[model samples]
Target: MLRSLCTPSLRLICKPTTRCRLYSTPAVPKKPNHALGVQNVKPWSELSTPQKVVVASKTTVNVGVILAGVALTGTIVYYIGSELFGSDSATSVFSDAVDKIRKHEELVAILGEPVKGHGEPSRNSRRRNRRITSQVVEDANNEPHMFMRFYVEGPENQGTVMLEMIKNEQKKWEYKQLYVDVPGQGLPSKRIYIERK
Candidate 1:
């Protein structure tokens, strides 16, 4: 029994493997006001249009109304998509997620390093019984994946950092895979695969 308990724990160090990081991606700045889910998409055929015209204007108006409606609907759908998934064409999720984890300062300190990036968050990791904020999404290459960055309070009272990214939709942040600069962990970070404490 003493031998089993006294066995040295294996210490495995993971290397960072991507160009993204907590402070490198462009995510929305933490804001007092924020946008959440989808809005609305109105159909075009229901719009008001003249029944008769001088040169078959009814068809033209109908077509025009349909197109306009489509455009409007498309815009709404896109907005909702981005909100649910992530920003359509920006990198801000990192910043947002980091902020939520409560290690903003540590993440910021690592940003100045020249060789830093996000890593995989552990599978079942936790700190102080709190859930870590995580998200997984593909890189700019359109790959399907995610990278979860976890923040925990260590025994020394310092912040503990870990990252993980999974391609499965079962993971979090499947929609938004972008990164954001934060002030928690160092740059060139990787994800971990631990469980909740």
Candidate 2:
């Protein structure tokens, strides 16, 4: 049995293959290809007219959108700055009136010290969100006039301030009427005239 197994093993080991085929070709080294290489770019001069038009349109649209955004931002900033800090704006007028009210002896005595000014009252507890009501209208003489109303509060009492202004020939705001009305205090709702036309 050992001789038979050895004989078969020797024969198998000594056997040679009669048929064989080569499946691989010779190896050849090649340079790597980059997707974004300068060699891959097509110059503007080489582009067709239609392709050029498309590119031009895209650039114009992008620039137009950017310019529009900048203009809108500038307009909004100018409006807010002028409204809040301009010398002739309603907010400036309100601040000036409040200062005068604070200096008045009668109002200070009745309303107490450290008076605060704010917009109209609302249902919300946060008064900061309240907006001051104001309007611009033309009078019978076709002159522009502004009317505004707000509230002022102190430790003792609160009152509503009414103001009216007219645009003068020099394009300046001139106070026509300014007053504070304190109601429900068992006193006459006397319109305290702070300014006259």
Q: Count the backbone clashes (under 3 Å) in each candidate.
A: 56, 0
Query: Which of the numbered candidates is closest to the native, going by highest lDDT?
Result: 2
Clashing pairs in 2: none
* Segments in model 2 whose C-alpha atoms lie over 4 Å from true places: 1-53
Candidates in order have lDDT scores of 0.43, 0.80
TM-score of each: 0.25, 0.68
Across 35-146, the per-residue lDDT of candidate 1 in tens digits comes to 6655453356544454233234767888999999999999999887776667322235444444444344443443332222233344565522333455545668776554
Model 1, clash count? 56
